[model samples]
Target: MLQPKARKAASPSFTSDEKVKRSTFSLRLTKSKKEKHMSHDKTSLPNAGPSYKGQPASVAKEDGARRRARPQTEVPAVFRRSRDDYSRGEVKVSSFSSPVGSSVDHEEEEEDIYRDVDEIEREREWLVCGTGAAVSPGNTLSVAPEVDILDYCQVEWRGSTSSAKRMRKGYEAVSQRFISIRRVRGDNYCAVRATLFQALSQTLQLPDWLQNQDLMLLPEKLMAKCTWITEWQKLPAKAENWTEEMKACLLLLKRKWESISEKKTLAERQAACDALFRGEEEEYSLYEAVKFLMLNTAVQLYEDNQKGLEVPEFSWLLFARDTSSDPFQLMQNHLNPLGHTGGLEQVEMFLLAYALQHSIHVYRLYKHGTDEFLSLYPRLPEAGWPEVILITEDDRHYNIPVRMCEETSL
Candidate 1:
């Protein structure tokens, strides 16, 4: 939980008249009936300024009528899932929807019971960092649209606090190399979102890459080499269901890619990709689909190490079993859930880069200065230029970094 900011003491230089006016204004804003009424009818407030102290009566009446006529925004279908449905691990697999749909329909119950919880969870998650408040309760994860890095950090840079200085300095460092940042929501899926957004978007932009069936089948290849169906079934009762779920998720990815690949023009493909990411169910399914590949990679690494076969030095250590930790258990606890477990670590990021056969270059920023600001996963010279460019302020959360020339690419 975040602590409330300490209030500053009033300056001794303030005159009694000024102090009295300030106190009176604050009291009026909170205690007055007119203010309370205005708060409920916010649309009536004039847009010319922040205050409604001197708005014309005629304009307010017109705005009020318009507000009354406006319909309430409908919640998306993906967010309407009940707690029970989510706990059962049932998901919508309709053509463009998520992986599987529940036979039981609860449309009435969905509108009545879970809507408020979902809204509260969404707002709470946005306010808190690194806290999986939304996903834990089975609410749909939200993604914020991309914004300029300068604009994203602008609010923090206005204060005289230490945090302000840190944010300002970090922005200055990033501004030198990047023009904008697409904030991948930090709800433990940041790594998956950032990687897919960059990698998939690049494929859409490049005709040669989109046309390559081998590239499209990369997930299947990873599964074959890493996850054996016979061995996977040995894992508890969940494995049987997971096998089916994994197949559905894999199909979801293929269909989405096929849909995007059908576009003849670069702009059309880009537009299709944008629409795909915007859908919560489709995006969540794709995120889960990638995790299967990640889990398979982890399993393969663990088995190879057990057999004394060569593996990446650091990558193998992450999944190396201890007295308390098993690689399979780690995957169940961390990879199965949407949020609250944890985001991908260094090993997984490297695995993703290798699994996708693309280099990932990340620009890192810190509170204080550092000798280096860039890190590349699977830093092989033979991999050539990075297909994904990312930025991180604290390293825990990752976002897409766009250069001035690459704005159109996003």
Candidate 2:
């Protein structure tokens, strides 16, 4: 009867409260079950990441032991080498798989040394022989040797039967006054040397700065004087008016003249001159410098002698109609060395003669025929002057050897 009364009247509010509590309890139980299931699933999954809160004690202890076992101060020896030691190969580098190191072979580095030495020797041999080595398209080396131009020519002395017989017809027609005929070295500089030698021999007779040296030293001394003159002419005010070609000529003259002056022996000086002629030691051709120097020296002498007298037109007369012609070019053809063309013109010769204040008598002896001797008198005997006799051969080649006579009395 009491239960029937309670059931009928669990008051509406109390009944609702009981129902709410029951629902809350049921929800809490379901949530707790779900949370436990999720935790079990995470533990069973193999690919699940590490969990900090759920980590095992054994695994944490193992990591701490590994950290303690490592040596913090110990490093490999290979990493301790200095930069210079590495560069010089003092320290050996090893392959990652190899424990022991090996060094580079020095013998392999020196293999080409002997080959380089042999090549240098071969080059020296070629240079001494006056030959150049040419490399062909086939990778073959060939040498071309230069021939001495004088080797093919015949030389004759004055008054010899061979000379007299060859000149029999023209013997009386030419002046027979020279004392001797001497052969000179045939090369690019022969004409210049011969002319210079003759000029020096005559000029040395007069009292000048170059009067004290022996005849053997005359050439070098004359070169020094000429070099000094060239230097003096190169002063700022004077050189400003010179063309580039003229300046180049002057530079070549100075270089060659300096080289000759520096040599202590005649052989050395001769070698230097030879080098200059062959274009071995100089960049500029020597012939132009020689021609320019000769003309300049002659002009200087003429001006010195004429002092106050009205000087005649020398350079202008040499290149008439070509008023703009370079004086250096007018003196000689300097472009080609092997070619026997280009020399002082007649006007230049006359100027040289006038500068010398002497008569230049050239007697050319023949190598071929009966009318072998031809005489050239630059200025006639009526002009009272010092005499310079130049003896030459029939060959019109400018490089032929020539000699100045000991006695030039005609």
Candidate 3:
């Protein structure tokens, strides 16, 4: 062979582009040589070695044998797993390849997160408001149907020393027969709630019609029974000029009441009534209805009590009217059951007392100074009266334990 020309030593110095090209070519050449060698070696290998075909089967068999070798125990299907199961990371990657699977997984995760959030929110509401089922989508009232009056009322005893002594003496005298004191909330419905609590406690079975009835509808029901309270009856004989507006209001109220009574659902009825009360023209109708109900109901109860038509202890209607108040005129002002500050007037209290009749005794407690305590007894007192008592302080009312009688009756 002609002596190979002296191979020039490879030069290290080169342009950047040229250097890159040379390196690439060298890598390709080396890869090709290695592949050729590997192919030749594979071809020359003996066929007597272990066959890959049987190797997979043997491995699978061995795995099955190992699994069977272990003692089996009963485990819930949810907790059970096989060696073939993919890890969470692998499953996540696979989920990405399948659109439906990915969407389903995402939805499941979202549901889990929502469930956790709902649980946390429910706990927070219970702790903060102390109300169960306080929030609902369509229900308006936040109050629970069954509530413990004592849970909401706060008690503070304050009075003069002499008053306290007097209260103590009264308590000692009544201690032998006195039951306990109960309190209620101080809203317009306070009197109603207080009186009802006493009545319900005494009655072995509440009237089916009254049992599930909304307390707010009492005025409306009473209005239905007493229709003579319209403006015609209330207006002065000389001032009986029939205004078109007044006639229209009376007609509208009649139709509204009919619609309300026809509504099948409580929510529907409440919404209809609310709408009527909200209307500027019809708003007065609600006031008139409630006023007449209060006046007539009170008068009826008073008359009934006088006639002894029913026993005082079992009567469900009782009212003691003020000596100098005009019942019809009283209805013109402060007859709003929806009002926050207006409904707790003496008139409303009288109405509630009349409704409760002799079912319960109301004890009005007063605290004038540091150590003075006074208890005002109910107007009607009869033998074997129910033991329920409600206390009022600064117009705030609540139920208290009968056993904790510090200062009693006056």
Candidate 4:
């Protein structure tokens, strides 16, 4: 090598020391190429793509790998817009495609707007009822027109008879009891009597024979007259109770059964029977007529007590016995004495008589299924009344035409 020192190759020869160095450099270059190929493959990956290209080639890429997975929806760039004068927040158009002021009709955008609005709404329905799902009232719409529920309502009816008296009386009665808790109690004596008679008359279902009679024949006020009822209630209950005179008046009541029992021992029933034949015109008087029946029946009862020839004995005498009272005493002494026709029937009649005397309000409904019916409707503003509406089957609306009152019978 010393002899050839002058012959050093320009590119360097394969000398022992030089060859080792050359081989090491070749190895390093090969390794570097392999690393470059790996980096290129990484950049070509489906996700980890796009290596930084604008940098020194000697150095490996320094940019970090993609991290966020979500699609970026950056706001549009701030462009000169008319709405800018009244806008808020920073606008970024990094990804926004539409121009700030441009009129771009996009189906995607329209769909998005509708979607957002639908998500925010609280009420939504898919109705398939009434009118074959064509109408929209009772169901609200947002975009164009709102369906009106009032338009779809249908309540069909009409009025027949307009009852003024009933309306007035009802209003008065209801007014009196508007604040009252009792089913039908009244502070006014007149009101109470009116109410009671109203109830009684309805119960009795009195025929015209009794109902049409003159009410003033009695010296004292009587229940037969509607107005008289109000006055009658004013009299103390003690005064109305039977007195000795009153008891005497009802004497025929005691003798009624006596004649049926002891016939032979008793006076003839002819006197009483004859009186009945005589008093066809209400002339003999209630007191005298009753007395005549008593005298005839008294003898009859005395005779029946000794003989038991009639039907099976009834024990009504235990509850209805009244031997001590003479006429009633016959039934009491004889456990099988005949009794009155029917207590319930008589009581009902009396109650009816009581009712006709009181009620100021009366409705004369037709008998035997007549079409005549009283219809009630709520009052209207045209009727010159306040806001009181009564809706009935007759389908008429009116103000509170009738005030309510405390009623004994309704």
Q: Each model's C-alpha lDDT?
A: 0.44, 0.30, 0.30, 0.20
Clashes found in each candidate (C-alpha, N, C closer than 3 A)? 5, 1, 16, 42
Error of 4 at 80 (Å): 99
Q: lDDT per residue, candidate 3, 124-187, as tens digits?
A: 2532121111122333331223222222221121234443443343333323223333323222
Residues 1-410, candidate 1: write the lDDT tens digits: 55643322221111112101111100001110111211111111111111111101121111111111222222221111232332232423112111111122333232122124454345445432222323323423233455677876664246555545665776766664556666555545667777777666555433343346654465455444434232221112322555555566666776776676667764565466667765355676676667666665665565665566777653443433121023444344345433333455444456777655566766555423543345556654233433676766544567776533211211
Point out the worst 10-residue segment of candidate 4 by lDDT: 23-32
Clashes of 3: 16
Q: Judged by lDDT, which candidate is best? A: 1
lDDT of 2 by residue, 83-196 (tens): 233223243221111111122234312211212444434433433111111112332211111222222221112334544445432322222222123333332233344454
TM-score of 1: 0.55
Model 4 residue 279 CA deviation in Å: 14
Candidate 4 accuracy as lDDT: 0.20
lDDT by residue for model 4 (157-177), tens? 011323323333333232332
TM-score of 4: 0.13
Off by over 4 Å in 2: 1-180, 201-290, 295-316, 321-341, 354-359, 365-386, 393-395, 398-410
Give per-model CA RMSD.
Answer: 20.1, 51.4, 42.5, 53.5
